[model samples]
Each structure stands twice: as structure tokens, then as C-alpha cells.
Target: MPPVQTVATIRRITPVGAYHHLVLDAPGVTGVRPGHFGALAIGGRDASTLLRRAFSIHRADPGTGTLEFVFAEAGRGTRALAAHRPGDTVDLIAPLGTPFPLPDGPVGAVLVAGGYGSAPMFALAEEILGRGGRVAFVLGAATEDRLFGVERAEALAEHVYVVTDDGSAGRRGRVTDVLPEAVTVTGATEVHSCGPMGMLKAVTEIATAAGAASHTAVEEAMACGIGICMSCVLPVTGPDGVTHFLRSCTSGPVFDGTSVRWDDAGTLPDDLEGAAAMTPKASHR
Candidate 1:
């Protein structure tokens, strides 16, 4: 289904670092999953950049035809989006990418995020909570200011652990330092994550060591939000050990960490909370 501007009204606009959430109306985003995303053509080709900037759906409210995004004011494209007004027309490409897989039975699930990576994890938390599956979240930030949306995540998880390099918040170290103990205490059997390469690696390592299933949501500098452009390819190691770059735009923003090679993290990232949030962790499956 094509995306349309139902109302395109800003619900809340706050400075998350430099970016803001337009939290507007987008129809046909109900099917969007936790790891999925959408592309916005807010200002059109008037600026030096022609194409649209991609943001993970922070949320998609089917009842209201509303969608939310956590975006950073990185460059020209996003700046254009920030300038958009209420009832403005912003084209959206939504329900893109597959959602994180749901673990069968009562599996302990852990979510780890760094910076804005918390976007998708929030949605995953809601899924786990809805299923009566317990979840533990580990969020890392360089400093207190780098963190956004911890309270939002707390609403979904059993416990929320914050680790800041500056020691202003919960733990005074990397998010990994809080993982082993938290997972053990929470009895986590599966892990979901979205963040920097290092944090993703740490989560993968912890899950591997703990014998838990691990999935990751990765970001790439994208030209096209859809899979048409092979630019956001992620290198993967197949069963035969053949290496190939998979398109993140189409193949997935969410993939088994074991399946995809955690190539160096992207220089730029995408907005994800609602997209990460929509990841279809079923209600009564």
C-alpha cells in the first residue's frame, strides 16, 4: 500500500540532541513492524539533496493514522523536514523491513541500545511485555545528553539499565558491564538490539556466551529507503562461508546477528524508535 498524508500534524516536537519528532499522520502504517522504517519526502528536491531521508518508525498508531519518528538534524535533508509545518504533506514509505522475530514460549528477552538505537528497542519491549515475556534493557551513551527516551523504554521492560561514560546516570561504564548480571537476574533467553557496531558486538558476544538467540537492527546511509538501491548492503557469511552484501533497505534492518557480518558501523544513522517499536511481537500467538 502506498503511504499518504492523512493529517500530517506534529504531535510533539522536542530537541533530541538536534533532531525532532514531527509525530504526524501516515496512513497504511499499521502493518509496520518493530525493526521496520519509513522514508519522508518533506521538502522535496528544492534543496541540494534530492532524495528523502529515512527514519525508523518511532510509532504507527493505526487507530489515529499517526506515525512518530526520532530524528537527528544531521544534514540538509533532515533540516528540511524540521522546517515542515502542521498539515504539511510529507510522503512516507512505510512498513519497510522485517520485524524482529518472536521467541516461542516464555523466553527471557534482553534489549541493548546505544544513542538513538533505543528507538526500535522500545517497540520490542512493548511486544515482550504484551506476551508476558520479561525483558531487560541496557542503554549506553557517551554522556547524559546523548541519551533520549529511557523513560519510554522503561514503560515496556521489566528493568532499565543506563550506562553513561560520564557517570551522571545509572552505571559509570559501557552498557555491557550491566548485561551479564541483568540477563541472569531476569532469566533472559533471547536478545534484541539496535545500536553502534561496538554495542551490537558486545550484545552478540554476551548472547553467544549465554546461549541466547541474538538479533540486530542495523543502519546505513541510504539513498533510497526501498531496496531499489543496493547502497545499504550488509556483508553476510553464508553457511558455505561465501561473503555477500545484503541490502538493508529491502532485505532487512533486522537480521540474525550471526547471519550478518557486523561490518564497521555506519558513519551516519537513522531514526528508529517507532519503527523499532512496531516490530511485530505478537499479542496472543
Candidate 2:
């Protein structure tokens, strides 16, 4: 189903370390799945920050008609959003983008997250477990405070590994450092991750090396949240063995890790589809 734009009232905002957990009464929005995101209008209807900020949906409770997402005060838009009080209404277009694909049958899977990227994994883990699958979590961040959802992950996953760069948490290293062990211990056949591009790339490589398929929710800038704006295009190789710039907001947010052109992220590759046409032909000498 297509997404709906609704004026969702702020239920409450809870401070979670360096992030804010926002809950909204959005009855109009439904069928939210893990990896889906919501685009919220910041400030007010006529505020200067015209662009809607995209946030991955943390949890959606259709029974309560409430939706949850987490964010940090990174800039003007997020700062304004952080200032919203309970009962205030914010325009939201939600349940957007492709969601993480669940395994058809019961299977062991490893979930990896970095920083607030842990927001979406709990729900995904729950669904995975509901299907009789086993889940192991490897959560990492720069510090302990930046890590989110440790308690919830522990409650749901069979094993939860926490790591921080400053040694403020379980281990002082990246998630990749503990990922192989997590997969090995859980006997996970699939690896799912959401985090910074570099982290996702590393996780994908590690998962592949461990003989597990990887699914990644890329953290790309989505200026519009919708596909209209070409801002969040990334090079992705399709099944036909052709590289095309796919929109993260539409074609994905979740994609097979092996399909992404991780090495050529920031720039268009010369071999990308239409690249030859876009490049200027050698001038007649």
C-alpha cells in the first residue's frame, strides 16, 4: 500500500542518552515494517525548514495507534523537532521505503547495529523470532551512551554483544570485531545490519566471509524521503549484472549487501549504466 500523510500528534518524547525517543499518535499510518522510515515536517507548517526529516521507524503499535522513531539533534531540522512538546502535532508521511525481508522459515540470524541504527533491529528481531528463528545481536557505537536498545535486544535475542570504541561498553572495538564470533556462536545463516555506510560495508564483508547472506539498510541522506528528489542515489548492481544508480528512498533502504557497489559509493562509476552517454565523447582531434 502507498504511504499516507497525516498530522500526527506528539505522544511524548523521552530522552535516551544522546538521542530522543519520539512517539506519535498516527492512526492513519499502518502496516509499518522493520527498516521502514517516516518523513516528518520540522518546526511548523510555515517554518523555514521546508524539508521533512527522514527517520527510521523504531516501533509501530497499531493497536495503540502510535508510532515511534529515534533521532539526535544534529542540525536545524532535528533541533526544532526535538523541541516539540507533547500534544503538538507534526505532519508525517510514514511507512515509507522497502522493509527488511524476513526469512521464509525458521533460521538463525545475526543482527548488527551501530549507534541509533539499533532502533529498527528489535522489531525485526521479534518478527524473526516469531517465525521460530533464532537471533543474535551485535550492537556497537562510539561510546556506551550512543548505543541504543541493549535491554530490549537482550530480552529478545539469544545473545547480545555490545561494543564501544572508547571501551565504555562490552568490548573496545567495532561491531565487525565481534560479528564473526556472534555468527559462529548462534550458527546464524543470515546477517542483517543497519548503520553507517562504512560499517555496513565491513559487516557485509564479514558476513560474506562467514558464509552468511547479508542484508543491509544503508544510511544514505534522503533529502525528500520520497523518490522524486534524486539526492539519495547509490550505485547498485542488478541481477542482470548492470550497475545503475538506485534511489535509496524508493528502490531500497534495504538491499542485498552483495549488490551494492561499496567501493564506488560517492562517485558515479565509469561503467555504470548511462555513464558512457553522460561522459563527453573525445572531441574531434
The numbered model that scores best in lDDT is: 2
Give the clashing pairs for model 2. none
State the lDDT of candidate 2 residue by residue for 205-231, as single tens digits: 999998999999999988999899999
Clash counts for the predictions, in order: 16, 0
The local lDDT score (0 to 100) that residue 210 gets in candidate 1 is: 88
Candidate 2 TM-score, C-alpha based:
0.97
TM-score of each: 0.85, 0.97
Which window of 10 residues has the lowest lDDT sum in candidate 2? 41-50
lDDT of each: 0.74, 0.94
lDDT of 1 by residue, 1-285 (tens): 433333244555667763476687665566766877877766644756668677887777788877788887778788777777665676666767776886555668888888777777777777777787888888888888777788876776658899999898778999889888878878888888887766777788888898888898876777887778777877665677655567787777787788766643332212222334546677995
